[model samples]
Target: MARLNMRRCPQSRNPSSEKIIDFYAGDYEVNDSPIEQVKLTVPITDNPSEPVLTFRTWVLGLTSCALLAFLNRFFSFRQNPLSVGPVAAQIIVLPIGRLMASTLPTKVYQCPLTKWRFSLNPGPFSVKEHALITIFAGCGAGGVYAVHIVIILKAFYKRSLHPVAALLLAQTTQLLGYGWAGLFRKVLVDSPYMWWPQNLPQVSLFRALHEEQERPRGGVSRLQFFIIILVSSFAYYTVPGYLFPSLSALSFICWIWTDSVTMQQIGSGLNGLGIGSFGLDWSTVASFLSSPLAFPLFAIVNMLIGFILVIYVMLPIAYWTNIYDAKRFPIFSCETFDYSGQVYNVSRILNQKTFDLDVGAYNSYSRVYVSVLFALNYGLSFAGLVASLSHVALFDGKHIWQTWGNAKSESEEFGDVHTRLMKKYYDPVPHWWFHACLITSIVFSLIACEGFDKALQLPWWGFLLSVAVSFIFTLPVSVITATTNQAPGLNVITEMIIGYLYPGRPIANVTFKTYGTISTNQAISFLSDLKLGHYMKIPPKSMFIVQLAGTIVASSFCFGTAWWLLESVENICDKNLLPEGSPWTCPGDDVFYSASIIWGVVGPGRMFTSAGNYPEMNWFFLIGLLLPVPGWYLARKFPTTKWLGKIHWPIILGATSKMPPTRAVHFWSWGAVGLFFNYYIFRKYKTWWARHTYILSAALDAGLAFMGVFLYFALQGNNIEGPHWWGNSNGDHCPLATCPTSPGIKVEGCPVF
Candidate 1:
């Protein structure tokens, strides 16, 4: 390789420091706005000789991976689950990395036979090395989506799955995404337009961790600021975490109207519209949607609009009017219902042997009806998926098309300054590696489906179709996730598709959905981390290797942890059987089970048809399909209506996607905090926003994580419940929120209207 015209880092950070970029002076200049902003945050420099996959990197990296996998998977069983992502607290770990670097021997030795060399401690822990470790952490930190299949099947449905099948399912679904990530990395990772807003926070934290910056006079440095906020977050979490858990959701209206069922239903943030309801706890503010401080302002606005429209405007009207017999059930719940205003007993309708729906039993018992909120979520999901596709195709189609062509030709020097540096110094990960991964995953998927008593019930063709659907939707869904920090899930679409085709097989429906949706989800996760690597200047192959290795380790641990818990903890997911205040309620798994009942046992054919109550929900598909068109035209028509261009229908419609586990208060508090930081604070204090915003997010996440783990082990783990009084008794002092409104309907604890 010859010495290239790659621009070196200038001594000063200035716009005029950029030099010799030929392509940007031409047609692609339109996309440079976002790329330019990225330059403001990511340093346009690289140190290629730094040893990335060293002894400290692997040991610390894999240790973090295994522990996080165990912690995340273990905590997920709790009613209010806590998930700590691997991206948090790079700054906090700087000392540990340094300690290992200092203590370990610096001796380099040759292998006994082969021409191989190794070292216990390489040079100083470089930025590249630390970034690589985080990548490994990230791969293990996330819960394996396939494990959800295992839990719901075994725990909820009481079905047995072969261990081999479960392991294969976990790995295939996870690795399938690797292929997609590699394919799209050129456009998604390398391209500046796909800025991947989520990565910027991690990037900010990385720079703060590794780079040395002189403290401003009379002002704290980034490191000092991070320490202060992290400690504050740590101390504050104890109040809500253990001492007074109800502080998590403080709805003043609920406090004011203790006796009124209607008022409580409207006021309860845990299960209602959450009007003027918010939280004092950082966990509550960040629940389901990590820290809202990282959410982009445009995303915050769009999601807020969608959330309000659904929760306040649409739901109140429907629930009050008894639409879908809403008054008979909780205003906000994942529970399915019968016509007599009772919870639907799915066991009575399912065949014990086949685990399929017994038609006669189902018909004789009652039609399955979800709450008004659940019904609307279904409708909105139908809209959100297509809305994403339409929005992406309409807004970003031309750029994607050009990028695809450029990637194929293999001659386009298409990337911002970061991509140019990577291309100049390191070997790009070969496309064949990802192709091999895709092929292997597909082959193993077939084996898992067929080799084990046909337990999965999905045919070979069904598996192929699921792959195609995932492939088709990955680009659009990923585009949405990249820009907005939220992606509409493919689970609903996949379940809906398989339900109609292969009805009465609940296991099969979930399996199909798992394969289709999880693969796409994993692909997006991989691409996000890759973009982080892109910004940090880690070699692409090293990142890929760590991701794959960490994924393998994490998948095994998630499966093993889940398997052990299921065996040891009797009556684990059974809420009625478990003792009061037991954290092992498996709330998210309950939602997954409810979905199985709706789409698999009863099936969409029966539930989403004219004979069913939710026939109108199907119309959302068309509504969402066309939702993006008007925005595109109006933005073009009114050139000066700049905000119109930013109004993304996909994000707006999918804003409430995480609702069942994530209640109105979660969105309410998250959106408020999001706007305060990303919008108001950002515009008012640009430099501070860039420097401290993401650091604050990391602090809250890390602080909450460390405290939650401590609380569980030191107190809750020993069956020693903290002091329980009025302040800690209930989430919002609103018992009647779960009550039914119909005259004769009776439910436990809820007032009868």
Candidate 2:
């Protein structure tokens, strides 16, 4: 219950003024150390005549985007999903660009009417073109999220959804955020204080790629260092990525107590508390939580505190106390359960004709339940959402207010160096263009949701409501992401609202949640990319075009790949009909389907109200609302204690928000690496940390991505499985970690009593 590490003192100065003050251990050219480093990575120079959106950029960008989309869609279903981000394309396309520059004919070509001219190959692939292509490929790196609705509807619900309807749904959801992105440009992108910490690594990588080979101060150059680590990481990943999978998480406690189910449950990294667990795989270390090296020291520290409080402390207490019959379910699971700890049969409570919940069948069957871990995550998420708003209002209110007041009157007066340079050189993307995109998307979203057969189930009013919520939440969420590299979302809250308003309408509820949540998230993503472009001095109009084009291309490729797999592959996502050890399990979609049932069909009234098992869980909202009070008071009381304001409650609570999909080992390993690089190296060897930390992160990602894709096509796709051995089997060597501890529960793979 004690959330803050507080030392109460006499109230003196205003907390609001004290919040922005900080003391630095080392000298900084600017108030922000990270932004000062931006001068090092991002060049202050600009070449106005460089060819951007050239023939090479268009062709390579399109090809890379399509390929990345296909791979993400295809590989996402496997046991260990391989996400080939734009980083690989950024590295791979360089040599190809060089070759094209040297080989292709340089004959000039002109458009029929306009002064626009092009060639088969641009002179040399300038860093601008390289950045554009990489940004374009980024459009499809993770695959479209809205495709999940199509998945549950067809695969799980067995409903016949037309391909055109599916296509419309995908495109609209993905494109709905352009307006929001445009509107927030002044606040999120143009301002100097909104330094997006996440995009720094990508900027660093681009600079390293263009830097000539030269070892500064008798040390390896950035280019040489990247090559060395890239090769080493590629070679090392073979052990955990293929040859031996258990190296991902070495559950030493489970290894020591081989026969004890309790011990395994207490120690397993993948499914349990991860008491003595460790990992060697880069994928395991950085998969769920992204590369730890990319995050700043303050953010990492906040996340670690949150992770420890939730995973190691509260999770154990909740389980051991047997609260809400915790012993009857697995230590960590997203699956809903019944009284006897059996997986709830969702079909049993559904009305076949109307696709609504059957009240009669529901009365006969048992009430639903989630694991203690899942329940806690939901509560913490509730807290995280409000705390973010409160934290931002208290800490960042003044800067945001000032930005809003004079953001347009005079750009040069209030802007930073990057903003000044951008404004002086390039024509800004007109505000009206963004307004048109927003309005048009809203009009089209209505048609898409309610147009064809009315299949999407979301009404016009509901879609408008979703937009309202998205509009309201974007600024706060963006502020959180812009500063701390963490985005607090409204996903859970959106579902809860719709589930209460219109219960037993699964598709409608999910559709509302998707638009409400992802619009904000997508806008934030676009903003991040824009900030990357800002740092690198890519023209705003060109960046805008690439983002739009990449989104359209990515959507098409995702739907095409998914539809093809659904048709050609036999019994996809059906484990019962597939051969032994088949990898098309659809774990993510299963979780999505469960959400539809819990918040859609079952409704929060029956599940989290008086009729439900966990009515008290709603109290988390109030708990989260007030969690930031103590920290603010302390900051105000002791203005000189600079670190007091750094206790970001939102980030700490949101740290473990992704726990079900992510395991305890993810945090443990991420923190381990982050401490070494961001904390220890950052303070001890600032220069080395600055040069090599981001290089190490980029190299690791690029190496694993290339190797993972190569392994899939070269080996796994051919049914050439890893050798049959102990190291390749039984992850974490903790088979019984998922077993329920209750006697006579009769759950599969558990003890009888």
Candidate 3:
């Protein structure tokens, strides 16, 4: 309970500071630098005495968390899963903060017993308090991906779980990441070079909102522009989102050739590759790929190149060429199939008593078949894994080593201006605090893994091993993400390890992967938020408290929402059980369940090794490792070729990161928007790009999220249908999108009432 005195650094005499030197000097030159020149010149203060844990922060933070958790979980069940990102929370909470600041009682009120006296108003809603609210909302924004485990069990696998047990599973998995974030705060948050490039926009938005004294020369101020965009986006969403739903996926090609199976496969957004498709909906554009308007131009270009090469060029060639008789299946799908082109009957292959695979039944059912695109996704994942390691080593090893070597130095010369400013104000959260959380998290995980039937059958040693793996990979992943805005996930690695260690236990495999991979990802994300706090000068202790509280609140809401959806949505995952063209297809759960089968039930040995049917996929790891070598060598040999240095293999491989749930058209559309703004607009109007890009993104996201929630409750949630029309009908547009061209495969059609 130690309080640190916060102080602002004296403003430098130079009004226009052009250059600021730091230890990682060249790292930012390639992409958007976290410590921009504009930020250094601005006079900002870190006020540590500001009330951050006041009633306003808690009320607004919890409310935002509850709403975001519920909405994100609800959307996850949809065919096109969308998430309410942290940026949305960051933007929406600003007005709420201002409202609280204006209406709350100014007089101090004392607690009944404790010596705590705090004002509900807390004097003008400090930036730290606003950030604390965002941190809480962020904890709930994505609604704990691990909760899908319980959902998949109950909804897809027909194994019901106790609500309390489900909540604990979600809470423990999420909080484990917080422990890792706490442990790595020094390396990932305190370090000057750990900029976490994605967080720059949020930081920029914070400064624009709180720091600006007078309106700029531009006709519209940032705040005014943001509000306008938010209102405009919200109004526009009603058309594509609910009324004229066809606008969400406008495929002109499908309209032209409605009966052509080939065209439908290439053009349909809902069922196929979505080649010529376009969405009027901003939410559709940003759903899986994220807001492209926020990405750096160079990164977007690299991803686009890779996406086109893989999905458009390579996948089609492989499918049409009948690689693995791929023509027998749909060109793009996550569902597993039998060799006879029928949906794979998982229940038939599983033992009735023990959830293990029945050898005789499995042999009789024939080898499980995967769509070519699905198999290729695994290959790309393998490539991405090795490519990330090699790319980071070749490009970032020197800077990482240098930063580590100078870790003990408190010299301002080695740190960014923000880091130096922070040093003057607040002390970093104590390491013991992180260790305590880590120990507690481990205890909870052990109890869950051992005590609950719904929980995994993972041993204590296995749980520790997952944590150890997370620790080992955290630094490298953090470094990559901090610099380039990309982190190759630990999913494949974790699943492979656990699959080898404990085969035939699908629950244990997924649980281990959840703890190992998701924890690392969540830790990096939390650290990124902390770095944002550092830049904004939020007290470390307050950030910690809000994050922990938010995670707990999010867990409860997400679990409850998921449970409610499962109970109401009949035959959630089974297409045969639901009405045709129902939006509630559970694609995310399909992908998750498919992974469980591939890695957990069948085991990695049978999927990638010589014993497996698809042994050729093992070559991708070597290919990924070697892919970056030539680029690195060329950059070293000819240093002047700037483009060579920017050829990031990890970004290229990451283009296929979410293939199942995300279509090729999502990348195409995202790349187009990124090109329009990040590439063209950024070069033409740097100031406008800096000022408006993130605000625009935040506004659009907030609008979409809020409208989606409203529409769901007003119409979909209550089972109240809008007026029936072609525009409002299931917007597939193309009946033959999922029809198989290969002989002996059954053809499908859209519902025509």
Candidate 4:
């Protein structure tokens, strides 16, 4: 194993310093060349032979995986859900790794039945091992969204699914994506230009942890700075998180004009555009668009533009203009309604025997209607899908083709330093390995779908078709996410295809959609982790084994947690049935249920066909298909004008993507922070910005996760309520924030219990 030389050269500290020696590339002028600019010169080879599959790795990995799985599922049920993203895991796992490295027994522990022996203490806790642990934790960090199938069946529909059957469905849906990701490693992971910029922060943190280096003059050490910030943040959150919940959504405008519904519509953070509202909670700001502190400046700007156009301009115009009779419905709601303005009676339209749509009942009842925001969400989703495909082809197609041609060639000089380093280890995981995983996953999925009491009702061929669609969309969406942090989701396209193919069965439609859409997302996530492993120089075979094991652990824990929560909480998705201040409101399930009704039950034919009530919605698909052509043409024709390249339509459409769960306040505040830090401060202090930005983001996330866990167990878990006061109440100070203003629309006064 080659040792990484740590001795400092003159060029190591500053890129612009004179008489600088280039360690990686041959000696060259210090003047900036975009391709030659090196952000991280840290050597890739750092104890390549260090033990990765040690007792410490397994113990920590399994513990964190289970903890994250539980926490993610627990928070998903909250009214304002908070995600424990990969960054949080990356930050929190560091000290645990270091502590274990120092304290764990060094003696090799041998398996009684086998010849294999593994040590608990891997010398000094190598960066590669630390990264592997983080990867394992990340695998289970997100609650399986496919579990929504089980949630809706039991909670809202009052249908029963055996625990065994539900667990199998959840596991199959989650792991299918891993197989897809393995198949696409060549394009998404191996290619140098697919930077996966989001991983840079973690890489930087890894270096900060493992590398032997002195702190800058008068500046705080990374670990010291991290601890200080984490402590302060954890203490501060106690106010908005528990004692003063009203601070989470402070709408001064609504407070001033309590009787004016128009003011509330424009000012309320929870129920409207939230133009004047502000959130004190860091979790609220970071929930929708990830932490502004972590995003690249340009990406943040693109998000801001899209958010303004969609939320501020498009949404308000549609609502005030009474498009889809928006005034009759709540301005921002995921719930579907009948034409006569009542909660949609899905039971009346669902055939009890088959769980399929009853055409007679659907026709006899009034036509279904959606809020203006909901209608726009579909249009944007459609437009975003087309835009992402076009953007990648026009901009990155040439580079992709060139990389594919040279992928296997040893003489390829265009590869990045990380790629070059990885090539030294010739033992690549063979293509057959990935193929085997895919085939096995498919076989098991067929068993789950066909074996059990027709729970999913999706045919084997439908499963195969969903997989094929996932394969097709994987490369394009992966390219978009690699270059830009955003992923144009496959929800619209998947739903459209399934709706047309298997029309009347809601369960079958969502099940197919889950396989098609969630699988692609999982593939992208897995690929991102692979990129992380690549950067850290973890052995490919080891990475493959650990990732597989982690997924299995995550699936088991997720199933157990979901089952427990559903059994414990009464009327999980119903606000009226649960206690008034209970945090068990399942908002995510509400959205999932609505989607099943719109696309699965009513379906594309009844919703957008000529004889349908919402026939005009059909134009959105056409509009989306043609929307990106002009932008692609202009950018291709005028390649020198760099400003034209900044316009990414997919990102713009993604801004208003999930309105029910996210508010305009999130985008506005997030963009403001990004503009100040990522754009302005970054330009002025490049080195300082590079050093502190990611560290700050990690600290904030870790602090929130730690505090959230403590609060949940201490107060929420034991059913201990905080002192009842105006500050601790649910709403912002104003009671009439969501009151109806339109004449003849009966006003439901805001309840202030």
Candidate 5:
């Protein structure tokens, strides 16, 4: 084996200089590419002369995440049924799941098909190992199946898809995502300035796993986790989703309302609602956009304000003024007070977008919000960069400079031979690689999408317009989402785009009319991946592959599943099926509309006339737009701030899904739990108990995935076309036309007539 070289230095007595030099010394290397390392490792492994991870181990690692994904989809208790929705859940669950498996004797890794055909020596419950598997599963089989089961099976009135096909789709998608990521590992991961914060948790876990192996083993505990997932899944399938609704408090409430129609219509729909259901209203979302309470401490405050001003304040005002709905003042279209004090058409109002800003009613709302947020975020993110550097300059500036200089240093385990070889043959790819990869991926995606009949039917000019819109919209949107975590601004950007390009098309018609507009969403999602890579210490090159893999996996299946689920509907009565009022009813529409509307309305701004005036609501949406900044600023001021720093903003950012009355308490509580587990359980009890958090999380996710899958299949209940439960069907319940109906299904009185 070749050796890595360490740079020798003259003796220095100055402590500050010494520290800086030493810190960065390791970063300096002749060659820093992981791809080259891969090539070298390949030769060694293929020689049959050097020890390497066996094929069986590779398969075991790969399949583990898949298995977990399947379980999560089938057994979920959250909106993201696969339980991979929240980053915190992933961090907490995956390790625990793996640890649970770890404690289960050799049978855990046993191949279900061949049964212990091959095995590798133990590596501790590895964060990297399991995470890779989870991502693989998520991107591959999980991604595809998620779409397929939700769309095709449910749409066709089938209970489920062929198991083999589901698995194949999942695997293929994952592979593709990884392949794409591989092309841009350098910029996303290797760049020092680009450390994605979300990745740090994973890196810490991975490093700890390796370090812990040297310590005595008390073994990982899986009791609480294992039982939780099992019980959760069982409960999910047995309760509202499968068996008739039964809840003591709810039952009492129902009794007070003797009207079965109201009860059946309203209460029946409760099953599909999650904790975040309360916050889905325009007021809540708008509030979040403008509130400065939610901003990160380290992020600049002014840019956030600007963003809020544009979307929450400006666009809402615009849209409400007659942009989209000429005759309405943006009230809940379905909100009707009963003459006798009984609710009439309550569902329609609940179903309609509030203030005409609902993503469903007017495309402008989504576009304007996202666009302004993106622009604001892009502008504000620069401040974050300044903040980060200034913070470092004040504190760890020396260390950063050292790390920068050390990029030329040799690997610790390697000697001169390896170092020389690395210098000669391996070099870390540059940041430009990602730019190139982005271009290529876009091209390929366009090509692939063009092959689809519906997508291909788009005019060539429309396709070019879509790309232009995506390029214009996604960059800023990605920056905002990345820096602030709240992307309410996307709404504005999307509306502007759609309103400009496909001017008279219904918001629903944009996807069919524009071939590649959705790429804006994809770009942002991809950028999030890169953001994650930056935080973690994973090699930039390695991260490129990992992220690309996940993306490819997601892309391959996301659209298909979205399409299927949107088109499929089953029992209209089943709340889990496209409930009378839920965003999931129109799965892809919000995202697609966000882009199309932007192109149509804002892309040309004053130049191109719009079909209708955009609606205007209150400027309250600007509140949360600034909220994230203060918090970010405070964080930057106090990087070592104990309680706050311990709270991973990524998770908190995700928690924005929760409504305000509940958001603060939930965020802090969850943060408390996470911090306690990470610091106390994992760190303090480092010997055994806490190390397997990811494994546990994986198991939980698996259970969740399984439940979600089950709901998608079984809940349809033989109905082929009623309402799509998974996404954007815009109908309540299953999409099936002939779903079983009860007398209570009739409206109390028709108000629409």
Candidate 6:
């Protein structure tokens, strides 16, 4: 079973003690021959030799797609309808694809499949395979959170599509960048200066594949990887579930004295001894905190902005309005619209009502709520967008031109190299074919999307509107995603923009009015392109097909699974019934929706959108918007800083905004996945097989999520509608529940005591 190994060198240091195992066991080297150096160069399309290479492309494509799909699913974080499927494209999939490609003779061309004789071997896999894997992984990883999207689909599109299908369809929208990523990779990745922190895994994996055949052998390292997988799998599968149930909620433990202690000292108080460990997946707090990696830079600037906005801006305004008793908290929910019946219950009101309020609502004077701040933020963000764009062009025009110019040079060379590489190491799928496939897919989706009884039928006008908005925002959205990988509060902004621009139309209701908008197919295709540019190293022309194929596969499977989970598992989305204190609950909705509304209506203005109102986004957005400039300015200002200097700002800001200092588990988990793997598993062991650990982790998580969902059912006596674990309080005064029960009653584990 062990494919690679090693023995100690004769160095005098400690002979046996210095057990240096060869990590690059399966890699090949170009030094094998002069011809090998040029193996990647295919003949021009018009040349007689073109046919040979075309076939080879087919084989590589097919193989790469299949293996990647399997691995992506195998290593995914959650089997939920919306999880990002794979950890790294190049690390696991590309290496395996390259290994398979190595077996062919340098001169070989297309596979024997006569159906498409002129086509290259299609490589071992099609672009479809890779795209499908990537899209599904991303959606599966993140989709579960947006279950309401599925609910909308099922409630509206029941005839033609089920709830699960609707959920997948809604989720697929997030992947839209993949389709156009190839066209924009030059703007995103090829720029030597743009490291794209998130895409690092892709770079590593692709580079490994480009290595030559017979470079060296290190089987022992592979064996070590195998051992680690088994050990980790056993530990994760058994220990976390049975041996130490406490570990399941470890995130609470890690924050006990730190985050909780501070809260308690402030008189917020704690319910019990929290687990407080670094990483038990406490969705409630995790959603609010910046990601561990994006915290460092974000924290400093964000804290400054947060202090200014909360203390000086919103707090002062709040005090003057008397929205709260002496406490600095809001009197009502900033998430909802209606605030009529429960004026006395301040906490309940604050958790449920819309935050789009006039200053009068802030006053104890009792003013009717109005969307005053919302309009201001909406206006400002539009201004910010224009200003941001102009600033970029003004500041980075030369850099942009220079980057594109270099890309032009590389582009020409890439064509030849791509052709040859297709023959040698990959499969080439033509752009035209992919385009045709996409068109056909659109037509098919439109028909299926119409739904029975027209439950999910989109008005012709709304359909046109979504398409227009999608297209208009496509490039800009891609730019933001490629660089920052975040666009928080933007969706709410988009909704408001759309709502205002095209007044009185329920575009959100387009799930039924026009299922086409959220069908997941188009987005999957788009995300595939983004991924192709980031990872696979496939040429832009090739990405079209790659994304198209992936969309078809994922859309088919994802939708089905979503319908099953939602219909069978009742109230998973019910704010009160779901995980208590979790971000999935009603209160957490305040954070996301309020931020979006604030940004959407206020448009980054002084009241709702600026550093004074929403400091996190205002600071993070500004930093991200100015990253290219600072990166360039710093490069010039401190010429010596290079990676350390220009990068320090973006990385620090990104790390801070996304990752906070308090999140040790997030730090450790990422450190293990990104840093540890790169440094130890990828470096010390030197075998791509070590990548299996990611797959092992994903598989374990998927199983756990599935079991968790099932156990939830079991605990409720097979009643899917039963109360949730952890925060239900068994009917006791449930914190922030819609029905305000007294502290004495016991509803389940959620008791009033």
TM-score of 4: 0.93
Model 2 residue runs over 4 Å out of place are 1-34
**1-753: candidate 1 lDDT, tens digit per residue:** 232344433432322223422222212112233443365567665566678898888888888788888888999998767777775535445678889888989999899989999998888878887888787778778889888888987888778899999999988988888888888888887777788877877777777777667787777777788889888988988999888888888888888988888888888898787877888888888768777876778888998999989988999999999888888888889988898878889999999987788999988999998889999999999999989888999999998999888767764467656666677677889899899989999999999988799888888988888999999999888988887789889999999999999999888898899889989998998899888888887888888888888889889888888888988888889888898778789878888888989999999988889978899999999999999999999998998999999999988888888888888888888888988997788789877777788888887787888888888889888878779688866478788888889888888887666
Better model by lDDT: candidate 3 vs candidate 6: 3
| Best-matching candidate per TM-score | 1
Model 3: per-residue Cα lDDT at residue 479: 78
Error of 1 at 294 (Å): 1.8
Lowest summed lDDT across 10 adjacent residues in model 1 is found at 22-31
Model 4 pairs whose backbones collide: none
Which model, 2 or 3, shows the larger lDDT? 2
Cα TM-score of candidate 3: 0.91
User: Candidate 2: which pairs clash?
Assistant: none
lDDT of 4 at 688: 69
Q: Tens digit of lDDT per residue, candidate 2, span 504-559?
A: 88888889999998888889888998998888788999998898889889999999
Where model 6 places Cα greater than 4 Å from the true spot, the runs are: 1-84, 87-147, 152-179, 185-223, 242-245, 248-262, 265-277, 280-400, 403-489, 502-546, 565-572, 575-635, 643-753
In angstroms, how far off is 677's CA in candidate 5? 9.5
TM-score of each: 0.95, 0.94, 0.91, 0.93, 0.47, 0.54
- TM-score of candidate 5 relative to the true fold: 0.47
Q: Comparing candidate 1 with candidate 2, which one achieves the higher TM-score?
A: 1
Over the stretch 256-355, how does candidate 6's per-residue lDDT look in tens digits? 3343322221211112111122334322222233232222232233233432333235433543453312122221133323223222222222212232
lDDT of each: 0.82, 0.83, 0.75, 0.75, 0.34, 0.35
Q: In candidate 5, what are the lDDT values of residues 638-675, reduced to their tens digit?
A: 87875443232222222222221222222322333344
Q: Least accurate stretch of 10 residues (summed lDDT) in model 6?
A: 36-45
Ranking by lDDT: 2, 1, 3, 4, 6, 5
**How many steric clashes does model 2 contain?**
0
Query: Which residue pairs collide in model 1, if any?
Result: none
**Which digits, one per residue and each the tens of the lDDT, describe model 4 over residues 233-324?**
88988888888888778887887877777788888877887878888878777777677775666678787888789888888898889887
lDDT of 1 at 520: 94
